[model samples]
Target: MESKSYLPKDHVDILPCMAAFAVVVETGSFVEASVRIGVTASAVSKQITKLENILSLRLIERTTRSLKVNAEGEQIYEYCKLVLESSANIFRVKDKLVDNPQGLVRMGVPKSLYATCSKLIPGFLSAYRDVNVQLVCGERFDFVTDSIDVGIIVTEKPPEGMVARRLFDVDFVLCSSASYISKVGLIAHPSELAAHSCIPFVGDLDKQYWKFRSSHENCDVPIPGRYLSDCPEAALTATISGVGVSCLPVCLAIDALRSNQLIKILPDWIYKGALQGTAWMVYQPGHHVSKRIKVLVQYVMADLSRLSTTWKLM
Candidate 1:
């Protein structure tokens, strides 16, 4: 008997390459597609080639000018969309099984939180043994398509279309190493801060203009700093080294305050606002909340609640 030409083994399943194809079709460039998917452009091209070879048809008419999808490619794109949607549903159904929440849960967290909250993650993992958590930490927003399940952001306004659960309100305090403050003299008022060497957290300086309320009057003071860093940790390190005074979240400065490594300056003129910064748990609405996502969210909320009570600035 002659072997079948289109055997199951001979015809590779398209499921694996579906994601790549969808990204390429959407981005219209292999390089951009790779960036969105967090892979190299060559890898994307290879995946597309594999997909075309499996279907025995040219899907994309590649040229320097544009990446146009042929008729076959258009049909495949539609089918892939349906496949992905169906796959999402399958995952949703499977998620109902609490016995195991086995799958990747990509989470985005702030760098400062990682410094303080990284310790809590081990306990979360221990409790949810089946859930695989992938934590991505950064100072800036990393909100690419399908990249994260939950994002923890400290912002005044939440992004549109995403559910925002106010985890906690954060306050910033003007702090410095005891030696630094001693050398520069403590700032007694928001205006006095101009004389001190302030360290600014990059991208937040404009928003960080120190605000204080006194005797029913509000003060918004714009202070200059000689040092600036994108990472809060860097700012903290600089303060610790006696480089300058810095405004940092009370949560991040508590240990230093207790240890006398850093001293709170301008105690009377405390910066106060309605949680100048809020930590939010954001996720796309309408997407099925898998058991892993649910468990992770619950765990994080519980953890945040505990931290807020213990470390929240009054």
Candidate 2:
């Protein structure tokens, strides 16, 4: 099969114009995007119009007082983000040599692991005195759209594209507060959970079926939860208050387990087949990796080695 070449023509001069169009669409108004780029609103409007003409399609729908990006424009905006960031990184590469491990390193981490991972950042900053780090800590994240330098995501599979550095296992633990277990008694089997109170986080998966696996067997317990949340903290708080049992990452529940604040259930069975099964460090493997980013990743990798082991619930 013959592969068709991309960029068969010359659009080099209009790349900046595309960027301008992107900003207007992203900011939802030419005025706001112009303020951001330090340009006149009319100039931004003109650039977008030029882009629309070149593409032979309407990118934005503008009323007297409002602006909206059409479907085509929204898709282009995403590409513009990648192109602009890649262009910016090229310049950042030149600055890397002199600065060494000094500059801003944008990182994304699950908010649930912040408490566990936050310790590494302070040590990294102290060692690289000139480097400053910014973190986007949250459950929901988008590396490309959000401009995340690196993202630590807990999932059974890494994202399909970009680049990924497999970090370690993120073993899920079926846990509850010690008080809750004392009242409800210990869960002996995965199937027994159906009769007990449970807390589940809401996501794309089948929420009613909680899965567990053993050396030779696997089971999906039809456990129901009255409390459903997107935040791990909410589930943790609920579990702590003796509300229900919730599956949590071992890293998030480490302190609780160590302090006897939380109790692990069905120790013989693995909290398997759920979405949160492993940890991966994901990023776009562009041509250049800044010195600061390299150093930070090194530090993280060294520290994260300890996290790979099958979690000890003690």
Candidate 3:
């Protein structure tokens, strides 16, 4: 038996190992990839190392501060995405054969829509009991690279190479705590807003320019704020706490307005613009369209249409 030994001691399956490597590259960290795939960090590292050994190439550069995919790894990542997508399609194929929306649907949801999404989840699940959902939320998203089935985004234009269906045009209503408005006195016109303490929306710029529109006139006001933030919830909190007057989304401020926590200023003037911003359901049209994705999009469109009737959005 000792004399006849010529075979290798260890054998490895390439599929899962390759998948681990892909996830690592996609997430850009061994720890994050492990969390995504439900494995240990050591396991993710070993799999990528094993894949590198098999190929006889260093796909990624390992540093103490960062892990970067080299040129070769970038080329390999494209193929890896194809491989993983093909593997994912196997489930889609099965679902098609069975004529049922089953298995998992990975969706990217923006944090701003937490309230809307919470309302939609129960109804969607009840309609398709066999379909399972996994929602991924973050400050930023790249749907193509992250393997998201669909995404909800707020933008005037969709990301290049992705398809979009317009959900609604965002309308901003000027809101402030009743106390703030009472202290500052009434804002009879859009021009009067310039004199009051204004809480402007924070973007990449130092100053935020707010535009107001109507059938007869338009006004643009450039303003500054001490307590500036890019988050909607933060802006709403500051407004409700009587910090200053801010323009907030109608959907988000509906309950507050109804409860009299926040008072709407300039009742007839519209600050929301289609040219300024809009909400969309975006996805890669070239990718496989699973039954689950189709139904979810339909559900969202139908639900939002119903909700819009109450809030004056389309």
For each candidate in the order shown, give its overall lDDT on alpha carbons.
Answer: 0.79, 0.78, 0.77
Q: On residues 156-188, what C-alpha lDDT tens digit does candidate 3 reach at each position?
A: 778887789988765667889999978888888
Ranking of candidates on lDDT, top first: 1, 2, 3
Which candidate ranks first by TM-score, i.e. highest?
1
Most lDDT-accurate candidate: 1
Error of 2 at 142 (Å): 4.2
lDDT at residue 151 of model 2 (Cα atoms): 78
lDDT of 2 by residue, 184-297 (tens): 887788998888888886641646888878998999888778898876777777987889788876777777777778888888888764456567887777777777787888
lDDT of 2 at 275: 56
Instruction: Give the alpha carbon lDDT tens digit for every residue of 128-208 in model 1.
Output: 776788888864554666488887888888999788899887777878998987777756778877777888777464645
TM-score of 2: 0.61
